[model samples]
Target: MNLTTTTRQRWAWAFYDWANSAFITTVMVAFFPIFFRKYWANGLPSEDITLHLGTANALASVSIMLLAPFLGTVADQGGIKKPMMAAFVTLGVCATLGLTLVGESQWQWAMFAFVLAVVGFLGANIFYDSLLVDVAEEKDFNRVSALGYALGYLGGGLLFAVCVLLTLKPEWFGLVDKTAAVRWAFGITAAWWALFSIPLWLWVRERAPAQAVRPSLPVLLRQSVGQLRDTFRHIRQLRVVWLFLLAYWFYIDGVDTVILMSVDYGKALGFADDSLITALLITQFIAFPAALVFGWVGNQWGAKRGILAGLAGYVLITIMASRMENAQEFYLLAGSVGLVQGGVQALSRSLYASLIPAEQAAEFFGFYNMLGKFAAVLGPLLVGWVGVLTGSPRLGLLAVLLLFGLGAWLLWKVPRD
Candidate 1:
């Protein structure tokens, strides 16, 4: 591809981050847990609510974790990454739109819709991450990966700001109340996801595989299963990738746990909903600039070192969070999270991209995403079950420190490039 064309494709690929992030920021991170606890499952005990929400997230992660490797293999073999992403994006958008119809005390229906949306959100990412190699040269991975995350932060934050305003000032938008505004936010999220995804579909092009084929679905399934088994053995031989994934599994779990559960944790401590929402909004905007800076950090210091620095920051943040007592402290913690969250995630992706064989990008990234989803499975359940058993959300939050500490130790052992 010519330089002008290649640059356009890279930006187009990055914009998918902008597209899907609205769902994550508006629906998943800020609104869903808040609405689930205060609206849908209003009368339930706090621990029970935590358990239910965690279970929904875990279920979605498990589904994606089980299927990502196989699906990745199929996408690589078929050269159909865009088509696969389209299917999941449709699923996620439709499920998010479904959230608008769920009425009060319908936590089950709410959970059902939330689960499907999460599945769609994460499933699309497997193909999305794999496309990094297609859109940018290997040497540009860190910069390009960070650009996607920075745009994700900006795009997700912008939409989330409007969604937050809709809740805070429903009259301004001609909505009936906060409940009505929340429902409207879900619909808006779906629309934003679909609208921004169009650029990716139209502009970003997938690289044709070396041995592309047009096998029927049944035949593709059979072949992919066999390929997945072989790839499993193949991964074992790639010691650096294997070790790095093990490290990512733990640190990213801590990261995902905090993102998903922080609002609920603040609520359990008696903080108001407005405070929790504002704190989260602060993180999104702060993350926008911080993500870009980390891309530069990855370039100057190396991806592994950049990741290690982020993990150290996370370790400190987690510890401080366990002792946090007020809204001001929550905001401080939120800002700290923003500083490290995107940096860690962006660098890890670029680092892995540098390590994997380009020809197997989809299949290898499938394994990467699988471990990420599996980490999601463990992280939430760990927090949820511990909160239920210990009757202390603080203790549950503190438990995440172990994952970060362990992950950092292992990451240190990986030889730097």
Candidate 2:
């Protein structure tokens, strides 16, 4: 295997981030929630829309959590991560395309489509992340991971900016109306996702397992179970890995929830969707360079310190967000989030990669993502429940600070690998 980094393969791997991020920003973050509230769930209370969003995210995470470990194990064992990645990518792209079919007063279908897209998005990402070991040497993990996220920020942000324009002023694009523009945005997302993914499929070569053998389904299942058991035992033995995951499970929960729920939170507080989109667009652009800078920070200060720095910023941001009284403050908070979000996440991925056994990258990352998805389940439910019960979105936003604080403290104690 070539240990030297190939620029072409590196970029190819990074482009997957570019591919899927459009769906995340445009469909998940920018427009879909607003569309759901105004169209599909029309006349429903704002709280109800929040509940539905939380429920959808939780359900998708639950589904992925249940299936991820087994699938990742099989892929690792069989040297089939790329094929599995292709399958999930196809699933996600199709589901995203399906969003074009959803119409006004069709919240059920919208929910169903969103769930499928999340499932595909998350499932593909597990394999994608695991491939980091395949594409780069151990020392390059931080930079490469950060590069992937940086490109994701750029790609997602660009598409989101265009989508926001189309939705806010369709006439600029010669569209008939905002509804048509929104639907076309879905098409753009699907196309962008598919187009960028081609580079990875064609260029980046997946690292093959040592021995490749075709096994019957029953045998594969048995092997997967045994592998899962051994991995769990190994994790228990590696106290740092276990502790790191526990810490990550907490911090990323806060991060992901903020990403998914921020627009809704801002909107509920009377901020315009256009302003929210513009603010977050700025976030994506800021995050692009910020992620790369964090990679350098991790190298200079250690991944733990870099992560701690980002989490500290998060704690301050979340607290300030809870007390913000106007849109300008919200925009400022959004920029802060951009500066740290990708950096924290990328550094965490590289840190975890360094801790795990490289041979079982796929299976290990599956558990990592499983814990991540499970955290998603809790974070949203926590924020949503508190928001509904307290009738104060500010209080709900405030509750997330606990997660960042706890995660940072736990992370500080971890020894450098």
lDDT of every model, 2 decimals: 0.92, 0.89
Provide the lDDT at 56 for model 1. 96
Over 1-417, each residue of candidate 2 has an lDDT whose tens digit, in order, gives 344448788899999999999989998887888788888889888888898989999999999888888788988888888899899889989998898999889999999999999999999999999988878887899999999999999999999988887888999889999899999999899899999999999888877676676677787778889999888888889989989989998999999999989988988989887788878898999999999999998888888899988999999998898888888898899899999999999999999999998889999999999988998998888888899999998898888988888788888778873
lDDT of 1 by residue, 1-417 (tens): 899999999999999999999998898888999999999999999999999988999999999999899889999888899999999999999999999999999999999999999999999999999999999988899999999999999999999999999999999999889999999999999999999999899999888876656788898888888989989999999888899999988889999999999988988999998899889889999999999999999999899999999999998998899999889999999999999999999999999999998878899999999998898898899999998899999999988988898889889988875
TM value for model 1: 0.99
Count of residue pairs whose backbone atoms collide, per candidate:
0, 0
Alpha carbon deviation, residue 155, candidate 2 (Å):
0.7
User: Which stretch of 10 consecutive residues in model 1 shows the poorest summed lDDT?
Assistant: 207-216
> What TM-score number comes out for model 2?
0.97
Candidate 1: C-alpha lDDT: 0.92
| Model 1 pairs in collision | none
